[model samples]
Target: MRGRTVVEFHGEIDIATTRQSDQHLDAATARSAPSVLVDLRGVTFIDSAGLGPVCRAWRRAVDRGGDLTLLCTDTRMLTILRLTGVTPAIAVTGS
Candidate 1:
């Protein structure tokens, strides 16, 4: 919440949806010190292709002196993020 731009992702995140996801993430992280919250609780599945855009967004936010947080309670998604080393890089919160 707060002043962060919240981007909620739903369904499966795979190669088929990475392009669109990337576009959205890029736009969200385009400004200076953009605080973004990526809501992934609605996501059912996610692959490495899906994580690419998220990592990129996190980097962009950090480079701009901002930050990105991930809100996910799904065990599968959380595991994927942990296994991919994204949990340490991005702030993750669960409900």
Candidate 2:
């Protein structure tokens, strides 16, 4: 929370939320900030479809030479991230 540029994905971010998430992800990329923190604290569930937005956002940030980080991931979410080998890519902390 706080001042972090948090993107809280509640449910699945499939075709439904893809447009909105893309907007946020694009904003995160366009900003000339040093870093962008996408807090997933409020997210209760996710799937590969949901992960698409995350990857898109991360790629956006990287394109702008900025860093992307996520926090407040639950066990299931953590497993997904770990299994996908993205645990090392995003700076995950304080789950």
| Collision count for each candidate, in order | 0, 0
lDDT agreement of model 1 with the native: 0.92
Residues 56-92, model 1: lDDT tens digits:
9999999999999999998888899999999887989
Worst 10 residues of 2 by lDDT: 1-10
Residue 31 displacement (Å), model 2: 2.0
**Candidate 1 deviant stretches above 4 angstroms:** none
* TM match of model 2 to true structure: 0.80
Q: What do the candidate models score in CA lDDT, each in turn?
A: 0.92, 0.73
lDDT per residue (tens digit) for residues 1-95 in model 2:
22446665565556677778788877766776536677777777666767788887787777776778888547887888889877788779874
